[model samples]
Target: MGIRDFADYLGISDRAISNWEAGGESYRPRAASQSVLDTGLARAPDEARARFADALGVSGPGPSAAAEMSVDSHKFLPVFIGSDRAHRLRTQMTGETPPDWLESCSAIVAHPHAPTCTLHVFACGVVVFHILQPRKPASLTELAVWRYRSYASDLPWARAKIHDLLGEHHPHGPNPEYVLSLYWLTAGPWIGSQYDTAMRLLSTPSVLVDRSAPGGPVPLDGAVEESLLATGFDHPDIVSFGVRGVSTGYAGWSGVSYAALSQERSLTVEELVSCELIVQALWCYTHHIQQRIEEGSDPSTPDRYGWRFLRAANSRLTTARAQETAQHCLMREAIMRTSGLAERLRAAQEALRESMG
Candidate 1:
């Protein structure tokens, strides 16, 4: 049985089980040898032995208490703060409880199964404990535990990013939006590659925004949209990976742009649209050439088909001399066909002029 079940059977706390598993004491299935039972088994020995055997689901007698028990410290670490927090909080809970590592920060945020304390580590590897206050609901620890599992299984670089992110600062307050964004920037590839994991992260507390707050920044709707779009563009194989879902990585990016756009000198939609068109044209032309190069032939190699297609596409686009002529022609024709659009444009111009006055 696991240490948790054993702890329940012995009527001891899980921490105590951790401590026992660490060293100072030893425990065994009571139904060992008849001689050792008389020596080591504590209190109402026969009854305790039967209870222990029943609790462990073992029918027959096991080894004596005198038999060497392998109490692994490494194994106990994961059970305590979990694999993610183990390396971070090890000294505070188990190893040499360093004086420098102790810092009075917060209260114990206990999981039903295992209590946890958050700590910061200094450059010298000294840990400073800042226990988190318990949440009213039990899901807080469950969330942490789930993240612990997910984050632990990440690539080494991704794990480092998660550690750096969580360890950096919490005093800035409940900025889950920011945290989620950082994860995207640093560990997005891993999260995006898996649909379920990416969706789970999105549903977490950090990504969700409070809409009712007055004077808050523009909602993260755009960033969320963009993120999901990026994921779809990059990882269409999420379904083949046994996860079926679509997600956006755009929300996080749009969230970041909130502060900038809210400030003075933001670009108008027309300007933005123009910029997007240019970028799109560039991307199409670049990708066409890149795909040809990536497929087989080198750029240095003369490709009759590629060069011919490229020249034709380039010829259709305007030269510097034709730019004004082309614009004049299009505007004259558009004015003749779309008088309503011209009226709306005039109204928008008048509104802007009136607002400035």
Candidate 2:
């Protein structure tokens, strides 16, 4: 921040700031001013804190080491394309070789909304669209405001892309329940353990920031960050999928994942996205049946997605496979419990049984 901006932020004079700068270690502000400075440090965006730490010769995870050297936003929209469509697209689109452990491959696709978007096709019936938007946020607060404002329109844009992709490629495939979102944060100004607070707020944006303000939501500045720091933040629906320090994130019913560092992330992005795809597709499928029960009609789907299909999905999702990590298992279970996927599946199963009887 510039000198004047810093002064205005602290509710003080620019000249006083100049004197403090000139005085260096010799001049210390009075008690009230010291309190204000402390709040400024606490409430300032992750970037400002990073620079402050850098100036003080304290080193940590600053965004300077990143390839971009600036903050960027990653948005993912995943849908189910099933095995057959995934195969067809694999042949149609030229893609880089997949990692031996991964059954997924991605390719750049023409998108009307975002030029830098790519389509990731997973062997297990899921496809995700990844969009990258470059931005220079002055503070985490500024970024928070932008996220709340832009998300209103982003869902529709993704839905349009999915509609087009399916219309042209997989007409008979099951429709996506919703264009659910998952966010990844890369190269932010936040340093040290501050990334923890940043990730919590990012994962559940509505907790600290009031997004319901009349003239659109505005950041409460230090009040926002300070409150979270003091009381902590948690929501039953939001699941923390990654570890705390090396890399961090949470996946929730509201959104899939929000993380600070892209490197050595605790949970693979593929697992989180695939988990969401299965959960939401099942959620949508069961909802269709539940609605039919509500309307006094017997519900039915193509034999492929019938009761047996749900039974296999339940076992596949609930059972532990040979090589699954505990973290991956925990994340999948948390998503199922929080989203009520298991409950929905049982309810749908019962309804189907009664109709068949």
Candidate 3:
């Protein structure tokens, strides 16, 4: 349920409930509020408080608050082997143990308002939360509109400070989760490559999401990309710019494959750490792509069998110095935009203050 529904049940304003969900404010529910949720849900007090805090984005009132908030629920999902649920779910779902740091994982905090539900795990003193959001197809018109708006919003600020400082904007897909789900798939080289390639693909506003039909592996030159590009999607290969790019495609597949993977395992500490690097790589690739696209060049290979060309293109984009330069440019542009807007806004505020005086 959304925050408003919970607030109404508790005789509080929606904002109050929102604050509790977001936490860290003076209004963050303390012991008393924890009691209300516990008694209302008839669940374990700790689980309830943790859920409350999680739904609100707060760390509940520590262990004591959890002690008071316990209750029980009858629903049960089969405990599978090699899964975190086989261990923690019974305790959490039954309100037996104090909730682990899963409720407070960084994935949840970073993507607090994501539409899809998430699963979090705590191992070795680190929290790794997996985010799962459904992916949808985009029409070419949708792509154009998305590209226009994304470029408009991101480029204005980018232009105010540094050149080539474009932001990644998805006009036609699901909402941009604050922390994109790059950690959900296989970790290591696959993750790294996908991270790097997604950045490169984003540079040209290409449709990076794969939507082949449900039959045998869908054709790469299918309707989805054509629909997104309005023209035949010019590329070296249908899958991974051709077979060589499959490693790159593997990364994209992993980034968007949280659902299939979620059923198999919980997010690990190493995965989260790797995801940060992957995302940074993505940001750098996107910036580089944006710069080239703005100048009317395709960042991916021109021919379908152009792995060598794509590889060289990929190499130029992944060098540490290149990535760092792109980051500096984006940050510099953001600062300049902030400063300019602050100046104008301050002037307007001063004029009002003087008029009132």
The TM-score leader among the candidates is 2
- Alpha carbon lDDT at 294, candidate 3: 61
Each candidate's lDDT (Cα)?
0.29, 0.63, 0.30
- Model 2 — TM-score against the truth? 0.60
Q: What's the TM for model 1?
A: 0.17
Best by lDDT: 2
How much does each candidate deviate from the true structure in C-alpha RMSD? 29.6, 15.7, 26.0
Q: List runs of model 1 lying over 4 Å from the truth.
A: 1-94, 97-115, 120-357
Which of the predicted structures, 1 or 2, would earn the higher lDDT when compared with the native?
2
User: What TM-score, computed on C-alpha atoms, does each candidate reach?
Assistant: 0.17, 0.60, 0.21
Q: Give lDDT: candidate 1, residue 348.
A: 31
Residues 205-294, candidate 3, lDDT per residue (tens digit)? 335332333431222344554353333332332122111111122123112211111211122334333333323322322333344446
Indicate the worst ten consecutive residues by lDDT in candidate 1.
Answer: 71-80
Range of the 10 consecutive residues with the lowest summed lDDT in candidate 3: 71-80
lDDT of 2 at 336: 79
Runs in model 3 deviating more than 4 A are 1-107, 110-113, 116-132, 137-231, 235-357
Q: Write the per-residue lDDT of candidate 2 for residues 1-357, one digit (tens) a residue.
A: 799998999889999899888988978876556656654654566676557656655445532434332445556665655566667667666674546322557788765555577777665455666766666666556666776666656655656665676565444444444444565565655555555566666666665456778887777766767667555666767766553322455666665444533243246556666676556656655776787899999976556556777777777778866566545666777677667888888888778777887
Q: Once model 3 is optimally superposed onto the true structure by TM-score, how far is the C-alpha of residue 7 displaced, in angstroms?
A: 67
